[model samples]
Target: MSKTILITGVGKRVGFYLAQHLSKSGYQVIGTYRTPRPELQQLEALEVQLLQCDFYDIQQTEQLIAKIKANNSSLRGIIHNASDWLPDSDSACSISTIEKMIRIHASTPYALNLALAPLLQNNPLQFSDIIHITDYVVDKGSKKHAAYAASKAALQNLTLSFAAKYAPKIKVNSIAPAMLMFNPDDDDNYKTKALNKALIKQEGGEAEALRAVNYLLDSGYTTGQTLKIDGGRHLV
Candidate 1:
């Protein structure tokens, strides 16, 4: 395997953890972050290549593509973990809220995959991978987060198209997760309510997502499909 992976939105949460974990595991990890954060230094210590690009900006996204192309000859995988969660009800929300959400969740990934598809071809493992980190609300939709849900739904749809387009050379799939982790500011009551929505009834943590990503990377026949890591939330 090439052992080189690119991940986006690696400043915090799952993105940061994934980058750190993969880097420690001896992968050449290239990651992008919208902002500079202190925790990113941890990734630097692990020798992960870091880039700064705001997916909301088209020029920046284009520049990011150019940078990756100029620097790397080949890539083993690209994990589309960059995301934004803007609800329609927020005071900051406006008509462009949906546009911004789509740009981050759907448009940026669309552009990156199209541009980077060539680099993923001809891998030693016989295939490269593209994994979209989508959300559970993509199926049911959301009242307060209507725009957010719709954007994620669009991302999931892209998995089907890209999977068909890329075929045997590259596997395209998505991982839709629900309540995998809670924010640091979440209160006890809020945590309880969120945990109650899933049958597993516990915070699955970032390790759960790591497991899902590893499974797809190791699989030989799974593509154009979604591996849901939602702790059986739909059955509840």
Candidate 2:
């Protein structure tokens, strides 16, 4: 039987690409999108089951898990790929805004893992994995992007915490990517500065991030590790 994997935020960008890649590789994909996106239609056409989840509301986390449980589908893996990014400027970094960031990056994923532990363990296949999509700046901290950085840092720690709690049964890990894709409105100077930070001196691209997902899904012995797909940006 083909196995199903749940990937959140598959409406566009990294999530969309990852879902596309995994679907092609033959893992049945159950993807979640917060809003309507053209990519969601494409995913549906590709036979990927779509779930609409708004992570900003904590209540929706349980609602989403309940829906998944009701489906009675066994998950082979769960990729917490849904994330919200806001530069920490005057426009951002407010208490309410930071709270939303924490909910999306840390609380929601934490709740989903705990709530769905049973389904993940029921996998007759080798090891079911949970991969949290975190940020590379987590270790480095951010003066400007405080809200985004701090919330994702919490998730980075949760990856380790869950790894220990669910060890030897379900594997939990993370992927932290740097400059995987240029932001839509970024100028040439902005792009150049971002690229120059990486020792590899290039964007990691969607493939680099997707490859890490494939690794966690395939490896039985790996857990509690956050693979950096940052083109050596972590070194700087």
TM-score of each candidate structure, all chains considered together: 0.97, 0.95
Best by lDDT: 1
Give the lowest summed-lDDT range of ten residues in model 2. Answer: 85-94
Which pairs of residues collide in candidate 1? none
Q: What does the lDDT read for residue 6 in candidate 1?
A: 96
Q: Residue 4 CA error for candidate 1 (Å)?
A: 1.2
Query: What clash count goes with each model?
Result: 0, 0
Q: lDDT tens digits, residues 95-210, model 2?
A: 77788889899989888998888888888887889999998889888888889999999999999999999988899999988888887899999988988898998877898888
Q: Please, what are the lDDT tens digits per residue for candidate 1 over residues 1-236?
A: 38889999999999999999988888899999999999999999999999999998899999999999998878999999998888696565566999999999999999999999888984576889999999999989999889999999999999999999999889999999999888989999999889889899998889999999999998999999999999889998
Clashes of 2: 0
lDDT, candidate 1, residue 184? 84
Model 1 vs. true fold: TM: 0.97
lDDT (CA) per prediction: 0.92, 0.87
The regions of model 2 sitting more than 4 angstroms off are: 89-93
